[model samples]
Every structure is written in C-alpha cells, then in structure tokens.
Target: MSAETIVKKCVFVEAINLICILMAKCSRLCRGNIYSLLKMSKGSSSRERG
Candidate 1:
C-alpha cells in the first residue's frame, strides 16, 4: 500500500509503539533519579581525602 493509503489501525499501532518507547525511556530516567537520591541520602556525600 502507498504511504498515503495506510489504514487507521496501523496508524494507531504506530502511535502506541511510539508511546511505549517514550514511556520506557521516561521510566529509566525516573529510576536513575530515584537511585541517585537514595544514594545521596544514605550519608555518602563525599569521601575523605585521607
């Protein structure tokens, strides 16, 4: 089929795939942020230069 004649279901599937990709990235980013905060709050602010 020509690009212009694609059906609506295919378009909807593409949209869902795009959203899933974005959501996965967002989830990873949030996890990283939470991990950093957790590490920081656990009292390892800085290592002494002994």
Candidate 2:
C-alpha cells in the first residue's frame, strides 16, 4: 500500500517482462541458426553425390 512497495513491484514486473522477451528472441535466433546449418550441410552432401 506504500509508495515504496508500489515502485518495487513495478520494477520487478518490468524485469520479468524483459526476461521473457529476451528468451523468446533467443529461441527464434537459435532456430534460425539450426535451420541454416542444416540447409548448408544438405547442399554440400548433394554436391558431393552429384
């Protein structure tokens, strides 16, 4: 009910929000990296067979 408590709660909520956003971004980046690597290897293998 105090002003200090309200401010602390706001800061905690903001931190949690930021953490969630960063995690989502990191997972998307990781997925892109894995997809690209798989594509490159597949291309190389096909070239070798040809």
Candidate 3:
C-alpha cells in the first residue's frame, strides 16, 4: 500500500497496542474490547486534532 495507508494502519495498530496495555492489568474480557473501541475512536479524533 501507500505511505498514507501505512500510517493509518499504524495508527490503528498503535491504538490496539494501547488498548492491550490498558487491559493488561484488567481481568474482564469486555474491558479489552471496550478499550480497543475507545482507542480506535481516540486515534481517529487525534488524527483530526493533529
């Protein structure tokens, strides 16, 4: 793919990483998915802000 697509994918993966980190200490299964969703939203918004 192109650089832009790569960057976007990186953002997504970064968000996933952050979510995983946040859920690392939590035992609830739902928290991990919720954090992933939150991270996706945050990543998109942060790109706009940037």
Candidate 4:
C-alpha cells in the first residue's frame, strides 16, 4: 500500500484501541460503584436486624 494508505490504517487501528480502552475503564468503574453500594446496603440491613 502507499504510505498515505498505511498511515490511514494505522490511525484507524489506534482509534479502535483507544475506544476499547475507554470502554474497559468505564466498566471497571461501574462495577466498583455497584460493589460498594451492595456492601453498604448489606451492612445497613445487618445492623437493623441486630
């Protein structure tokens, strides 16, 4: 392929990689928030029962 075409392909691949990285980071953050909320609720419920 021509140099221009090669550069375009490299940019496209980089964009895809960046998007995947962002998505993975967002999922991890959401998982952490959910886990913390669950733990808080469990603790409150146990306290009420006791």
Candidate 5:
C-alpha cells in the first residue's frame, strides 16, 4: 500500500481504539452510578418502613 493509505489506516485504527476505550469507561461509570442510586433508594425505603 501507499504511504498515504497506510497513514489513513493507522489513524482510523487509533480512532476506533480510542472510542472503544471511552465507551468502556462510560459504561462502567453508568453502572456504578445506577448501583449507587438503587442502594440509596432501598435504604431510604427501609428507613421509611422502620
């Protein structure tokens, strides 16, 4: 392949890798937030019942 095509492929690969990393991080953060919210709600409900 030509040098230009090789460079383009490298850039595309790098972009995909970055996007994957970002998505993974965002999903983890969202999961953690949801878990915390659920815990808080459950605690409050139990406290109200008591």
Candidate 6:
C-alpha cells in the first residue's frame, strides 16, 4: 500500500469516529429531554386526578 492511501484511510476512520461520538451525545441529550417530559406529564396527570 502507498502512503497516500494510508493517510486517506486514517482520515476516513477519524471522521467516522467523530460522527459516532456526536451521535452518542445527541442521543443522550434527547433521552434526557424525553425522560423529563414524561415525568412532567405524569405529575400533571396525577395532580388532575387527585
């Protein structure tokens, strides 16, 4: 293999790793928001029923 090809492969791998990291962070954030929303809804419903 050539040095150029090796560099390209390294870059591609780095890009994929960066994308995966970003996706993981975004999913965690979304999950937290959804969890909080669910908790709020439950609390409101319970208050109404009581």
lDDT (tens digit, per residue) of candidate 3 on 1-50: 99999999999999999998877757476788799989999999999999
Number of colliding residue pairs in each model? 0, 0, 0, 0, 0, 0
Model 4 lDDT per residue over 1-50, tens place: 89999999999999999999999999899999999999999999999999
lDDT of each: 0.84, 0.98, 0.90, 0.98, 0.99, 0.99
Better of 2 and 5 by lDDT: 5
How do all the candidates rank in terms of TM-score, highest first? 6, 5, 1, 2, 4, 3
Those runs of model 4 whose alpha carbons end farther than 4 Å from true positions after fitting are 36-50
Question: Residue 49 CA error for candidate 2 (Å)?
Answer: 14
lDDT of 1 by residue, 21-47 (tens): 999999999999999998886656454
TM-score of each model, in listed order: 0.64, 0.61, 0.48, 0.59, 0.66, 0.67
| lDDT tens digits by residue: candidate 5, 1-50 | 99999999999999999999999999999999999999999999999999
| Candidate 2 ranges beyond 4 A from true positions | 36-50
Of the candidates numbered 1 and 4, which has the greater lDDT value? Answer: 4
Comparing candidate 2 with candidate 3, which one achieves the higher lDDT? 2
lDDT of 1: 0.84
Spell out the clash pairs found in candidate 2: none
Pairs that collide in candidate 3 are: none
Residue-level lDDT of model 6, residues 1-50, one tens digit each, is 99999999999999999999999999999999999999999999999999
TM-score of 6: 0.67
Q: What lDDT does model 5 reach?
A: 0.99
Give the lDDT of residue 39 in candidate 5.
Answer: 100
Poorly placed runs, candidate 1 (over 4 Å): 1-6, 44-50
Error of 2 at 23 (Å): 0.7
lDDT of 2 by residue, 1-50 (tens): 99999999999999999999999999999999999999999999999999
Report the lDDT of model 3 for residue 4.
100
